[model samples]
Target: MTTKKILIVDDEAAIVAVLEELLTEEGYTIIKAYNGLEAISIFNKKQHIDLMIVDYCMPHLNGRRVIETMRQNPRYSTTPVIVITGSEKQFSNFPEDSTYQFLIEKPFNLERITETVHKLLG
Candidate 1:
């Protein structure tokens, strides 16, 4: 089977690095974006992204805006998104009908993240 491609958008370099290493070890290809604008640019160029993990507090556009923009495009309307944030209360501001089904709080365990990713990708 072909390896899945996952896009990770976050402003923290350490978070991106850790996710890249973890996901790569799991045999998935990862695309990293530092902010929402960069994430959108990557999405537009590499349109085959299989999954996306976004940080809610990113600069330039923020995660909700990124997801909303992608959802507006027919190509990504049904794509699965997992939102990670230090503040869970911020999730209430997301679109009422957004495609995201998972919210992972900050300081998450690696095992939990891996398990969630496997479940979502399946």
Candidate 2:
């Protein structure tokens, strides 16, 4: 099977590193971004991304904005996205019609994430 590429966006370097390791071990290609702006840049440069795991709060552009920007391009309109947030209040601010396929709270279980990834990319 072909390798799936997943873009992981978070302001925390540790979160990105851990996710990178975990997902890489699952055999998916990972693209890392520390902040929203860099994520956007990477999104533009990469031809195709199978899925996204984004932090709800970030610098430059929030996860919502980043997802919005991505959805603007028809190619990514239906791409599976998983939003992770430490603050429940941040999630409350998001509209009901969120584009993301899943919402995972911070300090998430690695196995849960891996399962979600497999389900989404299956």
Candidate 3:
């Protein structure tokens, strides 16, 4: 199978490290960003990205805002995104055209995320 590139955006270094290692082992290229600014910078440079896993609560910009900004660009408008949140609040009001618009609560499982990536990319 062709390799997929996944962007993991989170403020915490631990979360980014864990996801980078996990996705790398799954044979996917990982691009990591600590904040929304960094994420946008990478997105601007990289022309193609298969999927994005973003954390809800971040320092610079929240996951929701990041996703919203991403969708504004036609290039990434259809990109699949998985929002990770530790809060009990629900996420709604996102684009419906997306194929993989999912919200995975924090303390997420590796297997679950891997399955999600496979389903979205496949």
Candidate 4:
């Protein structure tokens, strides 16, 4: 019954705020990052992250690069990542052989993400 740590990365402050509140209430330890570069900084210091929920489009660095960066590190190599994006076309731009676990379309259902997190972390 150990607590799962979730890193939520998005440049949108409102989106980050809502997700942080939702996941916190679900009993997961939440780590907040405003963008991909910030997410990397956070990851460097907190190497034991259980899961990562990253938005695809952000300034400085994008979610795909952020996840790729994490995957290169031994500590987070197998950590599950859920990528959120608004455009399916843009999603297709990511590498076909990438290590990310899920690609969720933007304006996603809260329950869907919650269920996904539970399924992955359980």
| C-alpha TM-score for every candidate | 0.92, 0.92, 0.88, 0.91
Sort by lDDT, best first.
2, 4, 1, 3
Could you give candidate 2's per-residue lDDT for residues 1-122 as a string of tens digits? Answer: 88999999999999999999999999999988898899788768756899999998887888888898888888788889999988774456562356888998889999999999999999
Cα RMSD of all models vs. native, in order, equals 1.6, 1.6, 2.5, 1.6
Check candidate 3 and list the clashing pairs: none
Cα lDDT of model 4 by residue, 25-113, tens digit: 99999998999888889778855799999988888898778988898888898899898887663456463446788878889889999
Whole-model lDDT, candidate 4? 0.85
TM-score of 1: 0.92
List per-prediction Cα lDDT, in the order shown. 0.85, 0.88, 0.83, 0.85
- Runs in model 2 deviating more than 4 A are 89-92
Q: Pick the candidate with the highest lDDT.
A: 2
Candidate 4's displacement at residue 17, Å, is 1.1
Candidate 1 lDDT by residue in tens digits, 36-104:
999888767746888899988876798889998878777777778888889755366664444686888
lDDT of 3 at 34: 93
Q: By TM-score, how accurate is candidate 4?
A: 0.91
- Which pairs clash in the backbone of model 4? none
TM-score of 2: 0.92
